[model samples]
Target: MDGKKKNLTTSWGAPVGDNQNSMTAGARGPVLIQDVHLLEKLAHFNRERVPERVVHAKGAGAHGYFEVTNDLTQYTKADFLSEVGKTTPMFIRFSTVAGELGSADTVRDPRGFAVKFYTEEGNYDLVGNNTPVFFIRDAIKFPDFIHTQKRHPKTHLKNPNAVWDFWSLSPESLHQVTILMSDRGIPATFRHMHGFGSHTFKWVNEDGDAVWVKYHFKTEQGVKNLTEEVATKIAGENPDYHTEDLFNAIGNGDHPEWTLYVQIMPIEHAETYRFDPFDVTKVWSQKDYPLIELGKMVLNKNPENYFAEVEQATFSPGSFVPGIEASPDKMLQGRLFAYSDAHRYRVGANHNALPINRPRNEANTYQRDGQMRFDGNSGDSVYYEPNSQSGPTESHQNKQTGFPVSGVAENIPYDHNDHYTQPGDLYRLMSDDERERLVNNVVGAMKPVESDEIKLRQIKHFYKADPDYGERVAKGLSLPVPQNV
Candidate 1:
């Protein structure tokens, strides 16, 4: 056998040193924009599909207001949350991940929960998912992970083998894969599930003191989920069931709401925290950092035009409004660029000019002239920030209270490696009935995976989470329990 291995290279043929993790200031990083490998990879991934989004293509949106109930001026200087009783206009979009524009609403998939708050400073988008944890923590593997979830290359159909194989090999996916196969996987309606920012972010007070924070939007309507049989039946009966429910509920004045809560950890606590605070695959326990009530978001108005308001709407987690800043979370750092790049490619460069995305304060950037530059390209103003013509001057008011960087730049993995403890803890918290349903649901999905090796490998992950959880899934799949996991 002739053995000739090759180094992995970028598009221009430069050999890559680290493809799994993006280049950062340090191992735990606020990802540098200079990571052209990341930018190029994400840019290419975003452009793979045109017009419609590559993921989250099927979605529904509504108008709402966020009413701050608790004073968080001590935690953050973000104007919207600075004063109690302050209200800000906002919009929210809900979508199913890995689904096409015409896919069913009741699929067993993660739901996108993106909110755009049009604050006085600018638009701040909290782009997240219904689940508080994610499948993977690194963004470089995102495109590949999504590929596994999408149609097979040769068959053009969903491949269970690829899905299970990828999830098995990547043990980091255990937390999210567990939740995705549990009762909460198929939410009863858009109003019934909780939403989470999922990534740890930074919050700065007036004193410029920063803290690591996680956001939770607890559903006021209560968390309700549909069983697999019911969800399957509904998917067959009405693919737009969720869309209709949201629109009708809002129209009939049955407004649904969620109380915004956050778990705030002091900045210094991050380095000493048991798990990687920035890892999107794990959650900061309420015990360590209790949920602090912040505000309430009430969605009472349905979109007037689906295509104009909902379809044309865009969001990016990088859209920040001072005091609120990005953390060193690798997945989040990748998303800060990926989401915006995706919007630019899928909805054009000037897509933000649309009413749905246009900020209340509007933008004052010198960057101009693409398709649909309808705002007169700044109208005779100088096209540079530091121009003598006084086009626009830099406002240092919104600077991040950035932390100091340490350690050499390398592809170091996250601080925590024990992924099973959290998932196991979550399993133990569930009731007996919930545990049974979780097992049955996970087993049902794994049944389509033909490879015994893949099946066993995944069972090992379950075993690692909880022995009972593992054995039940194994028995349901009619496979012998994995030993010595």
Candidate 2:
């Protein structure tokens, strides 16, 4: 044995006598239950995997830093963006939203673009997606909408019928559905696509003045996408294409970077906006609120261990810093609790204790151990506030400003919303070639649906958006265009 080598031992630190063979009464006889090493090894092996995420299971992550490119101290008090040239360490996870752990990376799906910034104050997670608008506006429909995107329970296969059925019924999905069926659905590589913090967020300045904001991360690599045929071919040939592309690019020192921009809307303007400002399904027009250049985010390092870092790293929009706070976006509100709850259930009660999820700055809490309490259980620090001991206390300066609220809380549907306007506007804005591709893609996807009613219903939504858009899809599907529609 090499003198420098350490002996292998059980988890309890007992040296193993023999690992190749299990203890037994005699050769080929009944195995002895007293073999603690064998029991320990088998038990651990049986529990090797944690439960996979319900969504965005397949993904790639990298470590990097975010550097402020422009001064935005007047807009937000977030310390990481306190001044131009200030840099903060961060981790980013790019993922396919609807795919399983083993699914193809190039599939036509919205990609999740979540970033966790290890700021001076705390970890601020900006959880978002590749698209600025989502399929549905409210969180209540989220589970049902996601169900349609996944494999059927009984058939255990991709169900186009379910997808189209859901989209046809949920007219608000038209904008996102149109984008999904377009060339941009399958990004050529993670580095070539844009990312958006879909929900409206609040940014408070040092003077306590606040504004509504939306975040956009424009890729420095230039937007590129795979055609439908090419994406399908690549999906068959190499399912891990996107994951490998990101890993190799960073490995070769060709780090991917994105310019961060924010669309700032004054607090008063939100109440009188043409559309619901807080709606995740709608986007703030660039004309009204132009993009303000904020900073740059570059992924420069790969994770040392995939499972320990990438797989275990969790993010929550609730992880806000001093200047940032949640908006009234219904989906964002639900996710504030849902994300942290999912992490607790899947990872552990002490999921925050994981090295990757742990904050860079010191963390103080009245909470104590549940499981995997690794930090000496806070070293006998007082676990309750208002104690005689000098325990951690909250700062009034950091408290969020309160706003007036007067509403009869009830299950209110946004039935009064004009969902077709933006989607129609979007269709008309596309180039001739883009519109043709969009029509062809929609027709191709809708063709697999078994129900003609669902197809026609969805086509009607297209027609409502743009006459030409509906007419083209109707022609492609070889269906008659409804006179009234």
Candidate 3:
């Protein structure tokens, strides 16, 4: 039927040798900046949708404050966390991962939980999701992974074939996929779900000592969710149910609250940890490193103007203060660039100049005018640095923590690629009814995958995670169990 197979190439017709992993300095690395292909793919993905976010397009936001209850100066030198009872004004945006700006609120999707703190040092954003882990580890696969989640190019509609095929091929998605199909997948309300700084980050103290940390925002309202049937009904009946609930709650003075906690890991522990601590797809067991209470976050006021306060508001993982910094999470590393770039493209070149995104303290930069340069473009002062005229200077305290990289720069897969253990452990932790519901949800989704091979391949992942999980879903889908999987 065919004399030869045509090779896949880039937009410029350059042959793509590898389509999976991104180039990095070491096995567990901070993604290298020189990976042009990875950059090109992500940069292109960021701009695909015009005037709206390519992801996390549908969202709700509120005004809040984070109040420190205990001293953490020994762990982080961030001014907001400097003393007991210190409070910092903040804004939080909750969103659905794969939906458009007009999509239903109650759909089964990952909820984005991003917070921007107006600290004296600058605007520090803790951008993450409801779940602690994500579907993929490397940034190179992000564009492709999202493409599978979105509409098919040809049909312009959601395709189960693309979704399950990608998930089955990439077993690293098991942990998050399982969570997505669980009872908590469709939250009853935004206030009822937990939020996480899904990526590991570094918290450096005054002495330059660093510790790897993960952030968790436990909902004071308690965990609540909806079933597929109930959620679907609500989606049809009231598409703005979640949005209305949030706005009404604050208006009635029933303020929503969450307690912030962090799990701190020794900087040296990354070298000897069981799994790559830097991998965003994996989680550090709470048993290994317990949570320490940091602060309380309370949302008391809804945004007055949806377009100005909520829609125009931007949060980027790259916006860091002195003590808080990015870890080597490849997904996080890629996001640092993509988020800011997206904001610049969507919001404008001077997006940061927007009141919602601007720092509480004045910001002065030598870089001048672009689109939406509404404020004084440095007020006719010398725009060039190192000028004889008085000008703002860099802060030495903002220096990054030093770490060594020794491995060859290439597309290196993680050394410890045991993707099943955690999902297996997660499946076993649920009660009988919870497990039943999870299996039912997964089966319903997998039932429409269209390819027997894809279904069988994915079943192997379920089997590896838990025999009962595999058997139940297999029976529900009426598919034969794969042998020796």
Candidate 4:
């Protein structure tokens, strides 16, 4: 575009004589060690790939800004939402969970909706999914749950027996399984679906008052999804359909936006709530706790480099600012450590120093040398705090508010946990047609299971949720409905 030709140079700016041919003995013998250019090129090529993510590996990202539409300082002391019309630059990555880097975008899997806000205090990451509920509430079950979703080790193929066996045994998975089998499982595009902070979080105001909140990013473009038939066809035709759609939309200046809403519950309500407030597999009734308008997020810029800005960009639920904090959700609590540890291993120890992952404000920490310590290693400053040297100190104002706890340190299940009511209610609320479609989807997904016991066990759970639901699925699977059920 500049209409000028430039010479090629090595990484260190040294000019090259000829790249097509390497230095060799007698021009036809083995290559010579004197070929520094050949060695550099081969070495760099060998290390080109970083390790892929354990989950949500296939993704698309964009640059954007979040503008507060209403003042929420009464609930959260976060500066980005301190006043009306305040805009904070942000980045978002929309991904498919349980997929590798080359998976199809239209697969029947939960979509990941993670956001990183470049705030004055620090980088605040909200890692979530499109659905409001998940398969399991406890993090200890995560590895096993994911193993079922992935290819079997022996067969190297998707195993329906493994999937149905796990889901049948874990009744808590029914809620998410039902949703995934429905039409909403395959979103039409990244811009056409809703995003959610599925885990409950804590918002602390300046007065140290904390409230439990759940975030919902309702799509302004409206919800659109692909049917099972269409999604399958598109997957074969264009595996990168969602990624291409997002890029084209932003490039054509038709930016997509989502309105941010939060369901806030008083901290006192946790004790008496019908369902566990911190459970990842449950949802709060909107009638009891309504959504409060927060702001709007608009993605208007596409990344110049997909590898640098999207693939290498890392986020973790642990990256919290001052006003926002973690809840007692077991799954979320595990992610606070798991996500960052995975990033450190997949990327590098200094992954935060990457431009795409860096915070807007200067990072002040006593952390010293690690792999890829790029920020000049903090310019030789004192690496430890509470020393006799001039270094950064802790802020008393940013201390987390303490909550009382009374429990023995042992592996125990939640005392008042009930995994059925909410999912039952969900089934009852669906229309006759929706219920039929759901039953059909479930039957189709479960038909491949080799175990009759697993099938009957899962059908029983469906029956417990709703008799009609169980009966329909039983008919579809050609299995007789149990008289006891």
What local lDDT does model 1 show for residue 417? 85
Against the reference, the lDDT scores of all candidates come to 0.92, 0.92, 0.92, 0.92
How do these models rank on TM-score, best leading? 4, 2, 3, 1
What tens digits encode model 4's per-residue C-alpha lDDT throughout 355-458? Answer: 99999999889887889787899887898878889788889999988889897899877665566777778888888887777887788888989888889888
User: Under the 3 Å rule for N, CA and C atoms, how many clashes does model 4 have?
Assistant: 0
Q: TM-score for all predictions?
A: 0.89, 0.98, 0.89, 0.98
Candidate 1: tens digits of C-alpha lDDT, residues 1-485: 46888889998999998999988899899999999999999999986544888999999999999999998889899999988899999999999999899999999999999999999989999999999999999999999999998999899999999999999999999999889988989999999999999999999988888888999999999999999999999999999999999999999999999999999999889878898898999998899999999999999898888878898899999999889999999999999999999988878899899989999895888788998687787787778766677576766766677578889988888767888998999899899999999999898888999899999999999999999999999999999999877
True-vs-predicted CA distance for residue 252, candidate 4, Å: 0.6
Candidate 4: stretches off by over 4 Å: 1-3
> In candidate 1, which residue ranges exceed 4 Å CA deviation?
1-50
The 10-residue segment with the lowest total lDDT in model 2: 412-421
Looking at model 1, residue 175 earns an lDDT score of: 91
Q: Write the per-residue lDDT of candidate 2 for residues 1-485, one digit (tens) a residue.
A: 56798989999898999999999999986999999899999999998889989999999999999999999899899999999899999999999999899899999899999999999899999999999999998888989998998899998998999999999999989889988988788899999999999999999999999999999999999999988999999999999999999999999999999999999999999888999899888999999999999999999999999999988999999999999999988889889998999999888888888999999999899889887788788886888989989998999999987777887899977644777899898888889988888888888888989988988898899999888888899899998886786
Candidate 3 per-residue lDDT, tens place, 59-96, comes to 99999899999787999999889999999999999999
lDDT of 3: 0.92
Candidate 4 local Cα displacement, residue 439, angstroms? 1.6
